[model samples]
Target chain A: MLWAYLHCYQLTLDTYTPLQQGGSADEPTVVYHENSNSVVQMNAAAKQHGIELGFGLAQTAALCPQAHIIKYDKDVEKQALLSLAHQLYPLASDIVINTEHSLAIRLDNLLQYYGGYDVLWNTLTHEINQQGIHYHYATAWGIEAARVLAKSQINQMLRERTAITKCLAHCKLSYTDLDSKALNALEKVGITSIGQLLTMPVHELGRRFTNDTIRYLTALRGETFPTRTLFRPSSTFKQHTVLPFEVENSQHLLPYMGKLLDTLSHYLRARNLTTSSLCFEIQLREAEQQVMPVSAATPFTCATAWLDLVSLKVERLVLQQPAIALTLLCEDFEPIEKDTNDLFSDRFTHLAQKQLIGRLKAKLGEQSTQLPALGNSHIFEKMTVYQAQGNGQSYGFDAAPTFLLDHPKPLSVASRVCFGPLRLQTGWWEENTQKQDYFIAQTPQGVRLLVFKDTESKWWVQGVYS
Target chain B: MKDSLSLFNNHPNIWRAREQPANTSRFALGIHTLDEALHGGIPSAGVVSIACTTGIGEVSLFQQVISQQRKHKLRVFINPPAHVCAPWLTTQGIDISQVLIITPDNDADALWAAEQCLKSAACHCVLLWSKTMAAKTARRLQVAATHNDALCLLFSLASKKPSSLPVSLELSLKAHEANLTVDILKQRQGWPVHNLSVPFSWTPDNHAIQWAIKNNKRKVHSLHSVS
Candidate 1:
């Protein structure tokens, strides 16, 4: 049978001492229950001076003057238990939460799922530890044996099959019963083993012993136990609605574009999953249902990209107007993961590149940030300006001349400084395209620029080298 | 020059072809095809400014690098700003757990946390888009990216210069109605400036990325190569 665990309980000073408050400085907090006589704390103190729990408070104080006491909190214990319970829910279906800060789920069903029971238990224990709650208790084969085995000993949990079952059967039920009378009842029939208890008539024991003992023992023999349902976290998924207009023709879909973008973008950001691609849908009110899906060149999880994409579709051919609705559905997704770095990536790193880009974008807006072109072309018609994209990648050349005026400028004539006769011909194919004189001239002030004269007999400084 | 040279003498009637396809990933892509154009996917550890105005396939290019890393078994950290999403990339067939993202937000805290992440040794690359970074600051980030062995792919929303941020690959994207151009302003090793238009697309679930592997079309696409 497989092992299932819902939570774990760790021992603390409160569990050991019903009345002890905080421990000495530099020591861990002591566990104590309020005003209880059988404090594990007092018992230890009594050993020092031959005094115990039955002695009066004055005697106990005389025996151990440094003892500090505190009240126990079931709520705190439960909160801690619940934190662990949440972690174990994914691995098991039937979780039996126990009183001493541990839980047991039916393990018979989990053996194959986990490759083996031991692996499952270790995995569960590891996950709980990450949350800062120690897991010292566990059980397998159902809560029956699991209840009695919480923190009994590591060897008990390590046993195989019947040995493990026998181990649980022998452990004390101080946690499950949690009261003196129950403790008194189990104190000396001399046998606390479930195997031994099973030999006795259950009904007779139910009549003679406390209900808690009867119930605890009954559940130990693979019986059904009552439990409450726990909620699982929601998975990331999204859907959008379409407007009611009928699509008679392409012009009618323009109005719905804005709303569609809003819906898709909202869903994506909410789950932190951006859509690199989406399928746009349109329905005709009168025609038989036709499911036409259109995907973007890229899956865009951003609103602006969604807007731009939809605008492109509409602009390409105005979607038919009077269309019943335009709906966007992202059929696929990429899960976002936490960052973990590679140990052997490049060492020639560019630090703060992201921060710099983010800052520039935040201040200047993307359209205005232009990369200075690398060239010294000195003619208004010969200089070029390129827009930017994803990383500072400049748009490759367009139909415009390979080189254009970096900035179109008024021609300067400084006593006919002759620019080299760089031949530019635009007239071979197109009429009236004039060739011009291009020169790299250095003014006396150290201002070096590429200058050119146009067919119109006008001169212009194209660009500078700085 | 300590360089391996292949000089194809101009034999007027020569029609010889190389026996095996050489790994022409001149830059990191190492695929001689795209490598000849993009030097090793913008270099390993440096601040690169990739600007896209309308439609230069900037995001697609980023995807290519991420795809390469995943294929070679490396981690990818992406921080896509809130405004521009479609063109934002998530492809490249990397394991979801290997790709970490800093959700887009306007506050400095989010970006700062992202910076601390880049300084770490847990990731192979860190890509970010900031609408507010300044010139000198961009240079400072580049320095950090170098120290950590992580490539910092920056999307500049602004065009100002702080004169401090030196970059290996400065690309400006120009997107027209249909045509796209990527002009390289600076290159660290080869051509200081050039422009190339490469077609790009993304499958939501990296289906193409994975298929490219199964179909053994890896030279053209490197995304889902399982180690």
Candidate 2:
């Protein structure tokens, strides 16, 4: 089987640049390993300033005083690599995230469908170029060989055994997966290039190098296959982003939140699903993490629509402390239901109605808006219920008051009975028992009220007919 | 002078009253004299302001109008005076599922919610209860309602001073026993009418009265026997 390997040489730089705030495109930037304290990757601007790889922090600062220094994060680099793999999943069927900054894709199965190698390579390159990531790729008969070649910056696609052997000969031994000890031993034995190492027999090198190095040389030569777990898209979407600077204001988190939502939108679209709610966990500097849940009335996949709802909620948000990081988690996913409509009818009304509810709930608290529903109760006050979402059950009742008061007021004005003496003596199980004689009373001012006389013989007005 | 007049006429923002397109579609108020006074009925799409006191049969008067507009569309009630009884809404033949009630903390949010519901085009009718409304706010609500072909009914407490807000129809309601006295304060493309009596559909139910009479007879017999 043929395999193709991709190496994201500037994974740290690419992931860091998008999240970096207030930096010009022409500005020089470099990311250095925290432990090693040496530059791992640099942009072209920094490269032009003679700042090379493995340069210490002091050396980098001395070379370009204006250079932006960023510490490398392995976890962020891995997430970026996985996100890149997810983007390319549609193009390549079988993919393995080989390293924190590289991926291996089996292309034998795709070659037949794509007709040829050139077409598949073009399709892969087009998708990668759109992401604006700097990558080097090499295709070979084995995964290890392809990874080694791509890591060494030898960008070529070789199908023939002779061509691959000739290409591997020119690559230095340092580019191989062998350890430094094995390389030093091989160098002491006057072996510099992979071409010289290939000339030696396995048993002849076995006495000098370790067994692991022997296995690596065999796998790099396409004699053995290494097992790897292929990458599959996760069912749930979760993304954690560290802010380059502390955002004291909740509204300023919009740009960072917006980027995460865009990525979420892509993830949802790729899976043909929609979500109605998203949980945002804000990592404050000195306070407990704040969780802000933004929900929509209807499930949708548009990032801008979700952002609109989020911004409405964010405008009223009071941050307890300055936020340093943000995590977006969405666990529930629903399949999109196609709305069937008449050819001439307007289809946007349904969506607009749901969006209106979302906007109202976002601005004025969730409980501010409610849908009127009927409840199963004989008591006048317990008959109506308000729901936050969904269509209420259609239940009909006879001749009720127009509006019910939460608390009954004492009958103060002189009133005449219009229609009355309907005794409602139910509610035996509940503590608040109903044993009153209800009446339809009209005051002298021509106002109709739903009045009742209780067990104490005191008159109380419950509601109005208007 | 002709050139200046032509310039004013050709301006995009300037339009004479005669040049404005008349909206003719209306929903019958189900009140004969009231419908006749407003020509066809209430204009189906613009803002209609009602000045009335609470508990004066004003809500029951528009019950039929609101119910008729909820045909697969939402009807929003912003800041109703009290809890709108679901059973009462059902009695008016309104689909409870299509009714949305928004109780905002203040009038500003209530007005904003009203404008949003009107402009959404998903709501066929919006009813807002406010004590006072500025002319600018009324005009904004009118524009929003007109854009989406939605009706907005603004209900304010009755005041002695007449409002000069731009609305399609303005009526002042007064309670008069079983009928409500509706005076058309202002109407679009029609002359104002005074003291149009519109009867309420909620008459005293004879069944309830009969039931009450039978119970009263039973109570009297028991009291007489005990004495």
Q: CA lDDT of A321 in candidate 1?
A: 33
TM-score of chain B of 1: 0.61
Which candidate has the top score in TM-score?
2
The digit string of per-residue lDDT tens for model 1 on A1-466 reads 4344433433333222321223533222223455564343333334555554445555556655655433345655664455345445666655656554656656667777888767866776676555555444555555545545555643235436666656666666554434677656655666454556646677767766877767766666555454534334234333333333245666455445554555455555555565545666665566544443434433455666556445544544543334554445566776443321234333112212232333333333333222223122322332322322335432221112212333547756453232354656555565656677665544433333456677787767654321
- Residues A8-84 of candidate 2: C-alpha lDDT, one tens digit per residue: 99987887677766657668999989799899999999999999999999999999999988779899889888888
lDDT value, candidate 2, whole model: 0.85
Error (Å) of candidate 2 at residue B203 is 5.4
Worst 10 residues of 2 chain A by lDDT: A338-347
What are the per-model DockQ values? 0.02, 0.59
Interface RMSD of each: 17.3, 1.6
Least lDDT summed over 10 consecutive residues: which range in candidate 1 chain A? A394-403
Question: What is chain B's TM-score across the candidates, in the order shown?
Answer: 0.61, 0.81
True contacts kept of each: 0.00, 0.78
